[model samples]
Target chain A: MENESFYDFGGPEPEPARPSIGRLSTVVANPTATGVEAVIEECAALSRSLDGILALIVATSDGMLIHSTWSEVEGMRAAAISAAALGLGQRIASDFGQGEFHDSVVSTGDRVIGIYAVGDRHVLGVVAAAEDVTLGLLHLSARRTAQAIGRVLSDS
Target chain B: MSEIDVINFKLVVTGPFAAGKTTFIGAVSEIPVVTTETGTSEGREVKDHTTVSMDFGKVSVADESQLIELYLFGTPGQSRFDFMWDILSKGMLGYVLLVDATRPETWTDAAAIKAKFDELGDVPLVVGVNRGTESDVDKVVAALRLDEAVPVLACEATDKESVKQVLITLLINVVEQLEATVKGSI
Candidate 1:
């Protein structure tokens, strides 16, 4: 007795909208409370553990300095250069089909600058003396520190 | 579309390679200029290096007790690096194209770059003829076939005041254009 003509022609119903997940706001309404203290504390610890370290900076992917052990001008320059270096490195990696860029290193006569990828949106820049530190040791330390900083940045 | 509360403005300095765009931004920027200079492979004879990405500088303007921060971006002039031009110019209030007035051969390139910007959107721009004598201004203007309404003036990129004047002129043009846009909408 069911009327077949009344059957609906529409396809499978659209899946229920995924439940919205909460995240830290990208646009902070208040400038004073940015929750950056955790990252700063982590950077401070990282710097204290290393010998002959000139500077340690945590910066956003977009070149904003988050934390640094150096002066304001030095920190700002480190942040900017870190961002630029990573950008160029990423481009080179992608163009060459080299999966997963690790880090970039620039060694001068007296010092060495290392930029390591911290999470999806942060970078860790470390400047240290070239005389005392071996490249392997420097890279390993930077990698560990970057991973630790990444967790701090990712937590809500 | 109403964003009067925003006090930060971005202006792009674009032109052909070796046009003194980087020097101009450095001359007026309060902060240390950030540059991405790589060794030149093609034009080593003219200059040993060229900007691969962009140069950034920051300046502050005080108008009637209101503080406005101005960010200057210098574009890479090489055609191969034009991809960066799009990225730097986004949301920019205006731009200045610096032409090396002594090198008349590069005038057409400057005009072409301006035309490219024009295709992007209606943004105010001025042509600054740099490193040219006062007499070179007229010849440069004629060679570029500049429109009468556009401001073309001689500028020394190394001198901070000259660069500041050019920047101010560009800002004036931006304000006027913004007003026109608002009036038309109303």
Candidate 2:
């Protein structure tokens, strides 16, 4: 049963005039690992393992692109959009008593957008073509990679 | 191709009600700004709508291989909705306290809000006086009892160049603060 007590939050807190450092820390945790470069390399390897993945990006929860398989402009755009989406998703889940938000997927006729939280301080955004892969396959493949990414972040 | 360093910084615009926070952001944002405005109370003739959340804009400064991405955020000016200000101002490098020169009555409230942010952190701040002249700027300085060194500029919220100038002024201060911080730490 959904708890109606979520409404007790008084009201929705507006987006801060600046990107939120607190929320960023909550969403992206510090990894135990010393080398974030190793994680970036892992992301590159993960991208290669998927046949349909067109673009893969790793970014800070605060919208800074850390690494990407796309060009600079595309990477920046994805990072910004992912940060906004993650913040809203987290709020909605909390407010509606949906428990902690895990990940989100947006599907259209042509492509799919996947956003997954990595540990606490990072987010992985993926763009894949519908023609080349099913959402089920994408999720399955992406979930395993998300776990690895989460571990990397958790340790870093 | 060579890689370029892209840095991101944040700046906030805040003040009392109907202080043109939304207008100022809309005037300068290169892309269609994101805003959260809700209907105002009935019989409020001055404004039918008021920003309940915030406004966001972006500007990019590119020099050679370095790119500085500046994000501008405008806060909801009502005292009742003041809780968001602290959240928004966090991690901000600097801010512009916009005051409506035409509304001298609102000056005290604006100063109070400014003082709150001033207490929040030691970031650089500038005063942007809207719908005011050079002389009105002096009045604002006096009302706020601001140090003579605080930068004050005549701001027209609808004028993009004026808004850009305000941002530039804040950016300069941010750089200076950063330099000072680095030097102190060393």
List, for all models, the DockQ compared with the true complex.
0.05, 0.08
Q: Which ten residues in a row have the lowest lDDT in candidate 2 chain B?
A: B83-92
Q: Model 1: how far is B35 from its true place, Å?
A: 5.1
Error of 1 at A139 (Å): 3.9
**Who wins the DockQ comparison?**
2
Q: On residues B105-143, what C-alpha lDDT tens digit does candidate 2 reach at each position?
A: 889999899889998668889899999999999999999
Candidate 1 lDDT score at position A49: 67
Q: Estimate every model's Cα lDDT from 0 to 1.
A: 0.71, 0.71
lDDT of candidate 1 over A1-156, digit per residue (tens):
121222232311222211111111122111122336666666666656666576677766545456666555445555655665666666566667677667889898977879898875677887777886777888888898889877766763
Best prediction by TM-score: 1
Taking chain A by itself, what TM-score does each prediction score? 0.73, 0.72
Instruction: List runs of model 1 lying over 4 Å from the truth.
Output: A1-32, A60-62, A98-100, A118-122, A131-156, B1-10, B31-56, B63-66, B82-94, B111-126, B131-154, B171-186
Which parts of model 2 have CA positions greater than 4 angstroms off?
A1-156, B1-5, B62-65
**Per-residue accuracy of model 2 over A1-156 as CA lDDT, tens digit each:** 121221122211221122212211222343323435655666666657666776677766655555666544445545555655665566556768678766889887867878887755567877777787777777777777777877766665
Candidate 1, B31-82: lDDT as tens digits: 7787778799898877988888878777877755445666687889988877
**TM-score of model number 1:** 0.66
